[model samples]
Structure formats: C-alpha cells, structure tokens
Target: MPQTLDAAAVRTWCSLALEALGREREEIDAINVYPVADGDTGTNLYLTVESAAQAVEAVFAAHETGSSVPAPADVVRAMAHGALIGARGNSGTILAQLLRGMAERLGDGDHLAGALHRAATLAREAVAHPVEGTILSVAGAAAQAADAFPQDAVRAAYEGARQALDATPGQLAVLERAGVVDAGGRGLLMVLGALVEAVTGEAPVAPVLAHVRHEIGDPGLEPCAAGGPAFEVIYLLEADDAAVARLRTRLDGLGDSLVVVGGDGLWNVHVHVDDAGAAVEAGVEAGRPYRIRITHFDTTAPPREREQVQRAVVVVVPGEGLAGLCAEAGATTVLARPGEPPASGELVDAIRRAHAREVVLLPNSAELRHTAAAAAEQARTEGVRVALIPTRAAVQGIAALAVHEPDRRFDEDVVAMTAAAGATRYAELAVAERQSWTSAGVCQAGDVLGLIDGDVAVIGADLADTAEAVLDRMLAAGGELVTLVLGEDVPDGDAVADRLERYVRDGYLAVDTLVYRGGRGSTPLLVGVE
Candidate 1:
C-alpha cells in the first residue's frame, strides 16, 4: 500500500474537499427544498472547512519545521476542533460532526484505510434523519469505495468521491428537483481531491481566501472554542455594477453562501474558504469580507453558568438600531445578530463575552426566547448576569433599553423596561415565502403575511389591508401606543402615517403615532401609535 498518511496527507484531503465544494457550491445551495431561502449549504460547510484550514495554518506557523511528517493524529484533532467552533448553519453543524468523526477515526489508528472507514461510519451517524441522495449517503459510498478499491492511493479516492457525488441526484428528491447532486457531498469530494493532489506531490499554485489551499499544520486539538478575534477582517469593495456582479459570481467559485447585502456604495462580502489569505486576496482583486463586522458565529459563545466576574450586562439585538438602544440602556455589550435571531451557540457566546456580570439578555423576538433562555441556563454556572427578558420584538427590546442604567442599582428599571417591552405591541409587513394558511386568511406564496405579536393577523395582496388588521389587533388589546418601524423594502414614512390615519384615525386608537423609516440604522419601524 502507499505510504501511511501523515499530517500533510490530512491537510491535502481537506483542501481537495473544499476545492470540490467551491466548484459546485452555488448549485448545492440552490437545490435545497425545505427552506428555499436558506440557499447557504455550500457556504456553511465551506466556512467550517475554512476555519479548520485557518487552524491548520496556525498550527504549522507555530512549528515551522522541515519536511518532516507531522503526526496524523495531532493534525486531525486540530482540524476537528476548528470545524466545531466555526460552524454556522445546520449544514455547518453536520460538517463539523463529519470532521469530528474523522478525528475519531484518526484517534483510533495511524493507518489510512481504518481512518476512512471511521469517517464513513461517523458521517452516517451525523445525520439525524439520513437521506439517500444527500452528502452523507455520497460520503458513505465514497468510504465504501475507499475500503474496497480504497487503496492508499489518493487518486483512487478522488475518483470514487466523484462517482458517488454524480449518483447523488438519482437518490435525493430535492437534488432531482433542482437538477443537481448534493452540495455538501461535492464539498467532501473537493477535500479528498485536494488531499490526493497534495500527497501525490502536486503543489498547489497558491492559497486563495475564497478557495481551499492545502496547508499541513495542526488545526487545533483543543475542545475549548472561544475567543473574539484580535483583528476584524473588513471588506471595502469599490466596483462598478458589472464588477460587483462579477465579484459575486467569483465568490461562488471561491466559496458559495456569501451574503452580498449592504449599501450601494459599500457591499458586504463574507465567505469561509480554506485559504483565508487567498480568499482575502481574491476579494481584494474583485471585492472583499473586509470592513469586517466580526461575525458572532465566528466568536465563542459566552460562557454559560455564570462566572464570579466583577460585573457585566449583555443585550441581544439584530440590527444597529437595536444595538444602540441597548447601549443607551446601559447594556455593557450588545449581542447583535446581523439581521436575524442569535443561534443557540451565538447566545452562549454573547454571554461569555459579557462575562456574566449581571448580564441582561433581551431576546427581541418571540420565537427566539426559548433559544435565548437555553443559552442563559448554560451560562448560569459561569457567573453571568444574563436576564432573559422575553422581549417579543425589536420595539420591546428598545423600550427595555430606555430604562437600562448600569450605575444605578438593579431596581424597578430592569423590571419596568422589560415590562414595557413585553407589554409593547408588535407587527410585520413582510411578503410570504410560501402558500401557507394562517388565522387571518389564506396566503399564497407571494402574498404578504402581516403579523402582530407572532400571530398572522392579516394576509392579503396589499399592504393597506395588512396594516389595518395589524393595527386593529394592537388597538383591541387595550393598548393605544404603537410604533411601526418599516423594513428595508417599505419606505416613504408618509405612506405608513397616511394609511394608519385613514384606517384608525376615527377609531379607538387614533393616528397619534411616530413613524420612522429609511436610515443607515437597522431597526423595525417603531410605529408608535399612542
């Protein structure tokens, strides 16, 4: 058989896997069926790999030795831990589990065949509900191939992964619908291909931030995955319209699942690739994750089980507006969730950052309360001051922020702010993603799903009717004050005021409200209808 695999061999495998993912990253993300909007599978897995890559580089940098074969066990362990901490979405979690499995395999033995078999078995276990046509199935098949034709030959491994990936479409329903194979599986293939190439004496051209470049180093074996980065990566892209479009397209090649959501002048690019260096270079060449807003997902979750720290206050918010509100309220730190709710791990990370010294965590969404509390409990042992005020919306969170005063002893303020938030009314005027039925009415895919306090109060083709139902519900609750914060799509402050005035001016809750819209700030319009 070929020479026993070493640290370099493992590095090559990861690089190949990431490269394969970069190639078909876009297709994989688009093929997802459950949540059509969550087209970030390729991106998620790619980021996880990229984290491992970074760790590997750090490992090697610390020990810049000769061409000596590093211990395979140590390298695999490092890579596994890196993947665990940098994981993002559901796909990212699965990928982390997959690498953890490989680490287990490596831990058990020093040979190549045994490690491959362990990975196959672990891949199978990682999926809670396994499917035939997905990455797990494909990876499993590849493992079997490695076991059978599975020589120490890395080339053979690449060919087998490819074959398995090709057969994925026939197995998975969603893949068939999207007319593509598994995205995650294709990513695995990239890792394998990279490995085969590396160990076979094929030198990579150069590392790219957007692409997975082979680097033989320890990826970090420690299980403790915490820490805010010393430096934040910022992306300042100056591109023409066509150039921006091309940059987005290129980002797909480097890694899929990049979020190109920012202002016209400055676009935000965040991609997790094997070669952070190469990825950054590519972004600079085209556009860049520069002007970096340190992703909460990248940083460690706040320690659960409070620590006996001196003091601290943490607040969870989505946009900059909410963040500012919390800051005004004396929140020591803002646990900002870019444009969505904080993930479970993210919540933990926030608490850890706050050091749990009287931390007050306001989960500004109804659905996110449970997750926030779960994280709070985990951090309870860490001496954290995490108070999970069930703020049902951004408005409520802001209300709580108004009364937050750290210097003042914990008194009626926390309770009052929290009560204000809980007592506050909430509503949304977003378009529907699917044809789902709600209490108000039947909503088609494109119809708007008007909501108030987590209930579908209205569903229609127009914003006016949706606004009426939402406003009416808020009024009926014996509450007169209202705040309507318009989203990105809804602009023209006058439109909301006029509509509310027309609908409820003569009614119980008059049109005495404040309407804010269109700002560099990101907050739900606090349509205060007092």
Candidate 2:
C-alpha cells in the first residue's frame, strides 16, 4: 500500500536514501570516470544526503515539544536547504539543486509530477553545459515517467531512472569505453528507488553493477584518464543571484565541471580547475565564500601509494588507568584530569596523532559535546574523516569500545558503537564538596552521593551502603550486566568491589558484574548497567 506524500514520508525518504548510498558508496566510487574522478563520488553523495537527513531530524526535534507536527512543506524545504549548504563534488551539487527544485514545487502543492519536472529542469539548468548520459538525463527521464503515470508516479519514476542508468554507457563515450554506467546516474537511481520505498512499504530491487567491478580491475585503481584539472574547489557563498550569475561565468572560463546551485541569497559553488586559488578568488569577488574546500588531485600517483591510514579510534578518558585500558584496545587516548576536561584543540591533536584517514572520536563526557563537535569540524577541514560518539561516561565509552570493529564499514561501525553506548546506563559515586540540592534531595558536605545518568539519585553515609542502594535501584529497572570502576583514592576500594560483586551475584539471577580500578584522580566509583 502506497502512503501519501507527507512530512513523515519525506523524512523516511531521506533516511532510506542515506542508507542506500552508504551501502553502495564504495561500488559507485569504483565506477567513477566522469568530471575528473578522484574516487569519492559515493562518499560525497552519502555526506550530502546525511546532511539533508540531519536537517529533517532537526525539524522533528524542534517540534517535539510542540502540539503539532511540522508541516510537509517545512520538512521538504529543510531537506533542500540542508543539501544546498552541505553539497560536495560535482554530482552532489547537482543533487542539491534537484532537491531544491522539487522543494520549490512541492511547497506550493502535493503534485509529484510537477515537483519531478521542476527538479529535472533545475538540475539541468544548474550545470554549466547540460550533458546527456549523466544524472541530468536520469532526472529528465524520471520526470517524464512521473508525468505520464501520475497514479503510480514514484514507482514509474524509479523504473524510468533505472532504464536511463542502463542506457548511460551508450550515450557517453567515456562510460562505453570503461564498460560501466554513469556513476552519478546510478546514484540518482538509488535515490529514486529510496523514494519508491518511502511511498510504498517495499524496497525495489537495486540493479547489479557487476560489470563495474570487472571492468575497473582493482577498486583502488582510478578509472578516468589523467590530465584534467589539478584541483576540485567547492564553497558556500552568500551572494545575490546576479553575483552568482557572474561567478558561474567566471568559473566556467576558469575550468570544466562548473556547477553553481542555490538561490535566495545563498549558493553552493563547485568547479575543477588547475588554479584553485583563482577559482576561490572569483568567489571572493562575487560574494563572501565560507566553508571553502579545495582538494588537490594526485593524478600522477596510484591510489595504493597515497599515504592515508585506513581508520583509528580516539577516546577521551578520565583517568590514567582508563586511558591505558582504551589504548590497549587499539584506541588513541586523551586524558582528562580531575576537574579539568580536555579542550577541543587537545582532541584535534589526538586525532592528528592517530594519523588515520578516518577517526572515531569518543568524547566520553556530556560537557564536551560541543567541544568534540568543533574538533570534528576542524579535523574535517584538514581532510581527516571524524565521527563523534556521545558517550557521557567512561563506562559508556567502555561499552562502545567493546563492540568496535575497525574492519567494518565506517558508518556501520559507528552505528554499532553508538547503539552499544546508548544501551548502557551510567552512574557515578562522589563525595559532596559542600551543602547542595540535587535531584534526589539535599546533601551536606562530605556526604556520599550516588549520581545516576548525571543526576543525584542516592545519598548515604557509607560507601558500601550507597553502592548497594544504587545497584538495587539500577537493577530494579532490569539489567543483565553491571560494570564497576573503583577510584584509586577510595578507601577500601577493593573491598567495596568484592562486596558489590557478591551482592549482585546473590541478589540478582543471571546478572554478572565486572570491576576495574580507575587510577589516581578518578571519581570515587563509576557504574554501568546494561
């Protein structure tokens, strides 16, 4: 049964498209041969869709406290705006324009055919010279199919895009010579398939591109002929339409694969040129360009010769022992001392020390969320791929690290670690410094406070008593495993761990407990229930 096109449907579409792209990213990159292939078309498209999905999620989050759901128009518009601002590479820029075009028509009405037609037209117009046998042709074909089959437009459009993708080789000399379809057209087909899945509750079968794998020889081999542009430059510009018009003309004169997409005082500019600085200077003359990214093409070097580490983990630990523990588990550690958190620069430094092309950053403290995000952005500017997992405690970080697998796809590994962290509930035992009010109740100086999920949950006179109380409370909610980390300064810390381990074994059926000693300057104790 097909669902009506609405806010929820649009959100679903973005999510499905992002997931589809992630799964096919490497395959698409293998087949990339047009507009100067640097082997990142799939990654670029995935990032673009990820931004759009994040924007849609933000809209839902904003409306969560309100009485009404966000309107469909608002969701679609946010999706387009997000793509426009985050667009990367030639294909991604065109994708942003296509979404923006559909958004323009969809905001006015719910006619799918009209939106598809507008998207195709805008995408073709965004390119400097409309080329056949590309994403533009696929979009045009989908739009035509949608217009012809209004009742089953989503499925018809998907089918039409699939056909166009298959015929791309015959239409383009490069694709024909490579024995592969257009990478951008294939990506567009995946997006259209996602739309079909969103409208109807079933995913259509994706077309096989086995010929791409056979023709490309090795996945690492660059398929395109050498000697195009030396650099690919992209930036977001805050400028008027007239300035963008001039910027497009200037960029077209500078190099090939010119794409300028956006409207209403903002634009995403993408071009490949031998002189990257000159392209950027043109943007400066036309408008204020920010988020400017200039990537040099190493056309002479083989992909295997690139000095890039595959992946690594960087974690922020609260104590030396925890740091050592994480380091032993193959992570790069940044120690945060008592009463002092590591700054964003420190995290960036740790990321650099890891020397990985892709890094998973675990800033295991709630207070460092913004700091970690800033560090991730800075690292991205330096060409280091970073994913920040929000683990609010050492115990949560432990949970995440336990499930980490570097061999898996980056996105899949991040998802697994995030899920493991989220499933574990964390708490800490600390001595109060002075009289204070808390979620549990008031506590006097020197009182032992048990904080669950960052809130005071129990206040007791003895460490053992308080630990027992917290365990009982946490177990009342049902947990299979209990992780305890004892502080070096805590008196009789071993005794407490021993007693708690026995307490859990005797009191709870099928529940297990593990203990670790958090070296000097650590919190009194940390607990995790999972």
Q: Give all TM-scores, in the order shown.
A: 0.47, 0.63
Report the lDDT tens digits of candidate 1 across residue range 1-530. 45355677677666666666656555555544321223556766766676676556556655677755457777887787666645655456556666766677666564555666666676555333456766666567666666676555455555666777777767765555545556566666666666667667663332222212123121311212233222222244555556666666665565433434222344434453334565566667764433333322333432265545544556655555445545655564444433323455456666666663667777776767766787788677665655678877667766667666666666555676677776676776667778877988788987877776667777777666667777776787566656666654455556766777666656863445555442333532333332
lDDT of each: 0.58, 0.87
> What is candidate 2's lDDT per residue for 493-520, written digit by digit as tens?
7788899999999999789998988886
lDDT of 2: 0.87
The residue-level lDDT of candidate 1 at 75 comes to 82
- Model 2 clash tally? 0
lDDT of 2 at 372: 92
Record all residue pairs in model 2 with backbone atoms less than 3 Å apart, i.e. clashing: none
- The candidate 1 region of ten consecutive residues with least summed lDDT is 216-225
Per TM-score, the best of the predicted structures is 2
Query: Over 4 Å off in model 1, which ranges?
Result: 1-292, 295-313, 328-340, 491-494, 497-512, 516-530
Q: Which segments of candidate 2 are over 4 A away from where they belong?
A: 1-4, 208-211, 215-224, 304-530
